[model samples]
Target: MAELLSNSFPATPTGTRFWAVDKILLTYLAFTTILILGWWSRVEDAGMLFAAHVVGVALVVFEVKRPNRTTWIFRNWYALPFVASCYKEMALLIPAVRQTDADQWLADLDFRLWSVHPTVWLERVQTPALTEFLQIVYTLFVPAVLLIPLLIWRKRRPEEFQYYAFLIALGYLASYVGYLIVPARGPRFLLRNLQHVPLQGMWLFQIMQSTLDRLESAHYDCFPSGHTELTIIAWWASRAISKRLFRVYFTYTPLIIFATVYLRYHYTVDVMAGILLAAILIWSAPALYRKLSREA
Candidate 1:
């Protein structure tokens, strides 16, 4: 009877438990937790959801090669707050967008943030061709950043996995910070008011309306530009994966970054500040990760 039952159940590895967390699994779990939490928080509308789908598939592939359960559960505790923070941010953004202009709020808070002088100096930052171009370029950052890990994984560069993962996590974290610090109305609103230019970019206009809807749909929360922040970080992180290819993309990174403004999706100030924010994260994170890894 025992043998029958044993046979009836799928056989387990000779001595291993039915589920055991491994490092890869832990990382996978962490990725899923972050993505879900980020999306559920509604901080950036569909951004987190998109990330979850993309990253979730990659994690599944990783787990298929090397299964682990224990590591996932053990590390689950560490991801709790970050997930909570993601949710907290979403809640704040919705109401914050409605209740007040995040930009003015920051101004009132005495932070005195400044975007780079270059974005504001430009005269045609809101042209239709430029706006669409900017949106398309900014959107490419996700694929660009994710491609690195996919390549490394395909090549079985396990040693570099953590580094890639760290970049991914830190890049996202910096974006979250930018959202909190600068929440200002983007280029379209700014242009319509400050420059009195007619908004001609239909796609940009629609996205802007959708974004505003998201903010007012729940609250108000636009300040630091996630589009700018994440795009820069992804562009920089591309270098870590391949200098040869990085050189190619690096040239366009600025143009793409600039598109955020020309399209009226981000304030020139937001892009400038976001660049600085990405630089700070990219510069400091490697050493910080090494230190934390050693301590761990």
Candidate 2:
């Protein structure tokens, strides 16, 4: 059974198409489409979606034609996020299993941690130069999303990539569970006591807010930040590949994460919890995977 499940989704041989979909490629195409369509109106986001599809198709074609499995793997880092998303959703649903008071968890934390601004100093450094640098650093997380696949392609390290992906999924799942078990309406949603600070990026904030508003469940799970978890997993995975350049690049992910609070999106406690969550996930991932692998 373990061997069968392990082979269920072999992340190799670009020529071998699983279910005629090329599992990783199909996931990328599906997620990109879902994000674009779910964000803007169908017609409005169509052009960008089409172009993205074209590029994705081209990349998959190149990967599939490439003689090596390594080239095929990195071309599809987009698949990892989908896996994480599933776990996050699972986390949200977990509280219901025990009939716990999720709202109380959210409210209590609001009074305990987010009430004071520990890193208020960061907001003061919001000069054009600093903001520009932070913005660059913040955007670095985007590329980290692609790093795992690149590592897989470069080193043919699919096992490591799979392990990293599993860790990310579990981290997100734990975070969402934290959300349910300790639902906090993030700092942005609870601005009554907070000092009003400019986020600078109104458009970006609105887009993100709208998405959260549209979510069907667990709106108050703002503690143990998802962005932080994602960045942490990416950074750790980057380090695993021994790519010093990307390891350094991923190191900056936490700074941008701090910027999330100064940008007035998350609270100081949320950021701290996120960092802590990353540590826990990093520590637990290998052991957990080993257990799961055995059970498989």
Candidate 3:
């Protein structure tokens, strides 16, 4: 099984030739070039932006020299920070592109669809147990993204692992573009008139709230909830790997979807949009990966 798994995704040619590095280089260069050329005046911390690009380049070089390390770093650690920096830079550029929030429109859509704001409604029956459980499920987003791919890697299923990674990256990229298109601070920020029910639970809620407070400035990423989209993508990727893993994630899916809105981190429409985005990526990622692989 291990031999078959290893053979499924043939290793890229070694020495001076990198498979995934080329695409990573092009994407990093394109995004950075646009930042430097188009949004040069608006960029708040040029030094950090430059440093991010430098880090991307350095990672690529390191991956080229140590091809065996490519799966772990490029597929996992490297992209996290790179994608995060891109998100931060895009946030800086959003005002220059548009100075508007679509929260009202989204809220209205939610009302028409469900007759009440889902989060606000859910709060009516919120219990300490439910809140704690939802928060615990929500926190699984990070591990879901990392662990499933790690499992595939451990099983020597490089092709499956790469496919999962590609799906995640594609989903995030789509959601980031959505963030820029319709920047929103979600229901928590927009629906100030509504009575807010502060999430109450055990130590988990405290930890979650503290983390949220630290990232309060990251308000623009709320339109299509990255948490919802990425978690669903992770679930889909797990299904491709093993039935048992898929069942484990499938149980958490509803909790995650509800938590996104129940916690007021995402509007109801954002969760719907996230589901749609996950579907699109799952359907299209294989072909996208195939084309990129062929090119590489």
Candidate 4:
């Protein structure tokens, strides 16, 4: 999977203008720089962040630099890993600048909405059989998110894949920005002691859950569930490529969504925010994608 994702950025013919991916990345880099600068004192490793931005910009230049005429590479696939790097960095970035998390607010909201702590409430129904199934589903979030798009790239037009890439990338990168604004440790950390029953799955469940825990940082990645956002985005975007693929996304996306809350990785509010985020991107981002593709 790493090898496949590493090679997602195949070199493309250098065009004479920036494509949607390049401009989107430039915009994202500029946004991060401003975020760092705005909270410069809080960010202890501001220099490293600025250095990341510099390298990000250099990648753009390496692809598009031209002495006489501007040459913009249209390799939007690179955005996949470029944005993945952005997500990975948030582990360090979120805690450096943000003093506290917003888990309480989210937890309180869930209580107000439903009059109970969602994860604690979920314990009544928690069983090893169900836990195992949901844990496996929860672990599949990345694979499900990546597979639909890769399928599109293999089966659909380049333009279609690029647009989908922009949306998927935007979904994740935007969620990271959401984390910057609102850091949360989710129900797992915040509500660990309240629950009496541990969600011990039968087989692959515990291993998968433990592995994701080891792999994930940015412990406060709960306010807006990237799992929920990108899964829906992948499902919706797949409609353009193939119904079979769309159906695949449709079936598993909700399961992925359920796993977010069921596995204690997100608050109900986080899931709602993710759904809203996905809706906004689906409704409004197509115009932005088209504009960026045409202008840059």
Query: What are the models' TM-scores?
Result: 0.57, 0.57, 0.84, 0.89
Q: For model 4, where is the 10-residue window of minimal lDDT?
A: 67-76
lDDT of 1 by residue, 83-179 (tens): 3345344454444333345654433332244443223444455567655565556556556656665556445554465465665566555455455
Each candidate: what lDDT? 0.51, 0.55, 0.71, 0.80
lDDT of 3 at 71: 49
Single out the weakest 10-residue window by summed lDDT for candidate 3: 1-10
Segments of candidate 2 deviating more than 4 angstroms: 1-81, 84-115, 118-123, 128-142, 192-197, 201-218
- Candidate 3 Cα lDDT to native: 0.71
Off by over 4 Å in 1: 1-99, 104-127, 201-222
- Give the top-scoring candidate (TM-score): 4
lDDT of 2 by residue, 82-141 (tens): 444444333333343333434334434545765544334355666555555555555555
**lDDT tens string, model 3, 1-296?**
34534443455454555444246435855765675657667666756766766766776767756667454444333555556666667676666555677888888898899998777788788988888888888876777777777678677665666566666666776777798788887887777568467778866887976786575455588778888888888887787678998998888877888888887778878888898888887787777667777633
Q: What is candidate 4's lDDT per residue for 227-281, written digit by digit as tens?
A: 8888888788778767888888888888888888888999999999999999999
Q: Is candidate 3 or candidate 4 better by lDDT?
A: 4
| TM-score, model 4 to reference | 0.89
Give me the overall lDDT of model 4. Answer: 0.80
Q: Pick the candidate with the highest lDDT.
A: 4
Least well predicted 10-residue stretch by lDDT in candidate 1: 12-21
Which candidate order results from sorting by TM-score in descending order? 4, 3, 1, 2
